[model samples]
Every structure is written in C-alpha cells, then in structure tokens.
Target: MFSTRPRDADAKQFIAEQKTLASIDQQVDAFHAAQPTAPDPVIIEHPIDPVLQTGDSQLLGGAMEIKSPWSEP
Candidate 1:
C-alpha cells in the first residue's frame, strides 16, 4: 500500500538539500561582494593605413606603383 509518510520524508530531504545549496550560493555571493573589482586597462594602438607609399613618386606620373600595407616589403 502506498503511504503519504514516505512522500513526506522525501520532500523533507529535498528541502534540506535545497537549503544547503542556497546557503553555499549565499556564501559565494558574499565572498565576491567583499572583493574589490578593478577597472579594465586602456590600450592604445596606431591605426594602419591600407595603402603605403614608399618612394617620392607622385600619382601624377605616367605610371605609378602602389603597394599594399599587407604585402611584405
């Protein structure tokens, strides 16, 4: 015969375990709150142009050479 007594015991055990987990989560939250967080560092970098002119040659010349920054010099 099925009894409500066993179901009640299982419910009580589940509630106890849930409480234990909740206490652990609270402790972790408190520890994190106590620690101070630092701000991210600022990074500075030079912007690379897609096209780099190596020599004194002007675009007005009959023929000009264009080099891509990605190409090896």
Candidate 2:
C-alpha cells in the first residue's frame, strides 16, 4: 500500500529545482529576444538582351572557327 502522508522535503526540493529551471529558461528566452534578427537577402536580376537571345547561324559559324586554347594545330 502506498503511503498517504506527503514527503514535504522531496516536494520542496522538486519545486525549487523546477523554479531554477524555469528561471534559466526565462534568461535564455530574454537573451534570444534581445538579439537583432538578420535581414532578408536582396536579389537583383538584370534583364537579358534581345540580340544575345537570338540563335543566329553567323554567330555559331564564327564561334566554330575559333580554335580551342588547349589544342595545337
């Protein structure tokens, strides 16, 4: 059979320990709250030129004529 009488010393110690943990949690929360949050990244996208977008045969022929820098003739 379980004892009906309360363990006062154990209960008091448990409560004190819980209070200490709660105080630590509060301090951690306050420390985080005081810190400044980082700003969102700024994305700058430049518009593509219409001339570069076109697939021209002359451009491809000119590009093909250029020898590879790694290869010797």
Candidate 3:
C-alpha cells in the first residue's frame, strides 16, 4: 500500500547496480580477449653475474647502499 514507492525505488537501484556490474564484466572480458595469448617465458637460460659475489665487505652486502634513503625502525 504505502510501501509501493520505496519498493519500486529499491528495485530500480538494484537494476542499476546490476547493469553497472554487467558493464564492468563486459569491459574486463574485452580487455582479457585483447591480451596476447602466447605463453610467457618461465625460466632464465643464461646465468647472471652476482653483484655481491665472492667477498662481502659489509653487512647486507650492497643492499643498504643500493637502496639508500631508507629508514630503520
């Protein structure tokens, strides 16, 4: 009786939310479809030379100096 308008408004809001979700789903599907299908490389074939190899003069080897401007708690 008196609750008809509120019920209609709630239904309209629910439909609008569902439509927005559907649009987002469609956009996500389109983006996924546009991506390259080729399988990415998993392993590194060549060996890399280490920066802190053989002898380490300081603590954390070159990590602290490499990532300077850092704060310690």
lDDT of 3: 0.64
Question: Against the hidden reference, what TM-scores do the models get?
Answer: 0.46, 0.58, 0.46
Best by TM-score: 2
Query: Model 2's lDDT to the true fold?
Result: 0.67
Q: Which segments of model 3 are wrong by more than 4 Å? A: 1-5, 39-73
In model 1, which range of ten residues has the least summed lDDT? Answer: 57-66
lDDT, candidate 1, residue 36? 72
Candidate 3 residues 1-73, lDDT tens each?
Answer: 4664677889899999999999999999999999977544443333333654445443334332222333455
Comparing 2 and 3 on lDDT, the stronger one: 2
In angstroms, the error of model 1 at 3 is: 9.9
**Candidate 1 lDDT tens digits, 1-73:** 7776778898999999999999999999999999977545544433433355334433333333443334345
- Colliding pairs, model 2: none
Collision pairs in model 1 = none
Ranking by lDDT: 2, 1, 3
In terms of TM-score, how similar is model 2 to the real structure?
0.58
